[model samples]
Target: MKQPTLPFWQVWNVSFGFLGVQLGFALQNANVSRVLSDLGADLHSLSLFWLAAPVMGLLVQPIVGAASDRTWNRLGRRKPFILGGAIAAALGMFLMPNASIFVAFLAPMIFGGMMLALMDGAFNVTMQPFRALVSDMVPNEQRTLGYSIQALLINIGAVIGSILPFVFTNVIGLDNTAPKGEVAQTVTWAFYVGGTALLGTVLWTCFRTKEYSPDDYNRYKNIAPKIVEKLSLTTKLANFWKLFINMPKTMRQLALVQFFSWFSLFIMWVYTGPAITQYIWGVEAKWFDAEFLHSVDVIPADIAAAKGAAGDWVGITFAAYSLFAAIFSVFIARIANRFGRKITYSLSLLAGGIGYISFMLFQNAEVVHVNLLLTEIDIPQGALNLLLPMVGVGIAWAAILAMPYAILSGSLPADKTGVYMGIFNFTIAAPQIVSGLVAGQILKYAFDNQAIYIIALAGVSMILGAIAVYFVQDNSDSTPDERAIQGH
Candidate 1:
């Protein structure tokens, strides 16, 4: 029997938790490097420090996915992992920015890195199950729409989380600068709010949506139920290895595309703040270090203020891209249906590549004014120009979040959805891990430690991803016409 078609609200409820998840992630992506820099990490070692996130994801997701596939309890199959991960992630968020307070025992950077690992591990545990849960619930025809809605919520959350630091600093009048070896109040408070948001939305999804029972799931997927058997730990490990070795063709083909895409993204996350600050605002990496600032003969207030402002602007730029992504998500299903997922995805990645390449062209820091109802706000012309490129990045991001999963869901066995989804995360994590390991060395040796050149390299990687998209075979049964109809 075919799975029942879920109503729009039910589909919305299923993915609502991602809003909070992305919120926490947005804060981490936009600000973690900046935080590490504040606590004394140099520009060259920033990506190495960021190795915590992808490393944790690489280790955690597959295990969580396989475990969740076999799990069923009073709270439901995926919900237990989701709720538990959210709680752990929330605690990590609360503590990570405050690592300086625990300096009596461990160095702040070491403690912060541990928290980063915990948060990312928890995020991977929570995220892998959500991907499977959508496949488990949504019917074949509606899968695109379901994932598109998930993308929308993810980008929406990202927008808010990305901007929180800027809002706290500019609107709420919080101190954006901190003493040596500490995080800014604006960033710390943003994490607190993000943690709360993460827990609240996850609870909503946990309470509002229900998972299918084993027998019902079997029926819906048109498969026979197998007898439950207790297996040895050795046997389980062997089974997991078999699954990895025998993953679907489509999954393997998509891995190359994911590698380039995520590699570029990892670079952007690690280098964007430093890149824009040095290239546009004339703020040097050394200015971000409190110890360096303290050791200077005369502390330049203007340089310090410029560094803080540049960091806040990085948050705003991240928010702009997320906003653009959210807007593009509204039409991703339709666009993919009209052009076919391959063409649509390729074109989107191409757009993002062009956007990243354009980063080097606009270096004007001339101030521009926007008149509010009661007052005026001034922003750098170059910063405002950066938003135009984000449009392309946003388009790519919308497709990246939705299309591959929509395509892959059709090829997966129903009972193995969780494990496969978890394994798929390897593609995402592996590239980031590689990028983290080498990006710093490339920046230091290849580009003379100028972060802007790394952004251009990311663009080249994205274009390669655009080209790689043509190799994947989409096995979904629904035609573009059917997808368009369902999307509407």
Candidate 2:
């Protein structure tokens, strides 16, 4: 059976929804900490608050992927999930702003966060089919470009999400002075924009890029007979347990490396924002409730007074990291072409490790120069420390996105790409669950809010994840190049 190839522009149109989808995702990643803290939630307990993210993801992702794979309706296999997710994301955005108070130990913030988590899975569901759809719809020649276009859209969406709150506060005059660690009106509006875009962009793809009918699909596509027709939860958990039990020689070795790599990234994402705000902004988690009251009069001018020279550098530091990622995205495919997937991955992780190590050495206040330097800029030790590592982190991030999939997609059987990818993504999503549950406790109990040590752990994880890459062994049995590489 032969797969049909869509024209380049059509392929781009089908994958277009990811632009809006990532907008919501980038907003979730960049702002969740800021939002949680503003709503009077305890920063020390934030990792636990974030635990909702993985719980929902682990529970929802496989099921949604399985369900969508089986779905056949007028709206098509992928559309319902997107439409539903968009609706939920909009509601979560609106509800997030109201999360300032507790109704009997159930913080409105927690409730809203759970809603966002639910929305995350629904969005993720539509995502799988689109990837598989590319294989189903595209020939080999255009795939590299097809995926790159999707990546570009994703990055563009992320830039907007990352900067929206900044735009909202600086230009739109939405007060950044929400309660300590609470959601701001401007951030809330960004969500509204993100959600609306998420729904509409997907709707455009659903209508414009049509799926082949079952008979035509069967005529051209080499699909295996459906496995199980459906899988029970017990069965899925059984497979996850098999991650340890009866593990293959290849996979077991990989797991040890994955654990450390993920642990580092978990710490970096969960703690960076609040940690930056606290040590530099001098707004401790312990002072959150007091800062909430100051919302009536505590302006940016006031916060700037507290932080001294560090405040201005904070945004630039974040922008610097994103800029690195934007550039990294362009060269990634070339690196994959040159080094072979596993080797390229290992090298990227090593670079990130160096970046993380640089962070520890550079934390001295004397190390940072002013961006413009006309006024003799001396930023806070904390912000300067974080910015340096972000360069490496961006490189590490690019590898994480491209490598494992390249390995897995090569190996997975064509008949069951959806299920296998779902199972594989478990590593990525499940680690988030663990990180969220443990990061805050580690900060509060292990190090007593000495956030620098936690970030160092992330660097260690990169070194470890790099080590694991060697063990991964590139078991891409079904990859397009598999037969040629084996010289069979």
lDDT of 2 by residue, 57-166 (tens): 66666666556656668877656665676667656655665565544667666665665566566556556666666554555555555665666666666666666765
**lDDT of each prediction vs. the true structure?**
0.88, 0.62
Query: Which regions of candidate 2 fall more than 4 Å away from where they truly are?
Result: 101-106, 140-145, 180-182, 224-258, 282-285, 288-320, 361-388, 475-488
Q: Model 2: what TM-score?
A: 0.82
Candidate 1 lDDT score at position 32: 92
Instruction: Show model 1 residue runs off by greater than 4 Å.
Output: 288-299, 371-376, 480-488
Q: If scored against the real structure, what TM-score would every candidate get?
A: 0.96, 0.82
Local lDDT at 144 for model 1? 91
RMSD of each: 2.6, 4.7
Highest lDDT: which candidate? 1
lDDT of 1: 0.88
How far does residue 314 in candidate 2 sit from its true spot (Å)?
Answer: 6.6
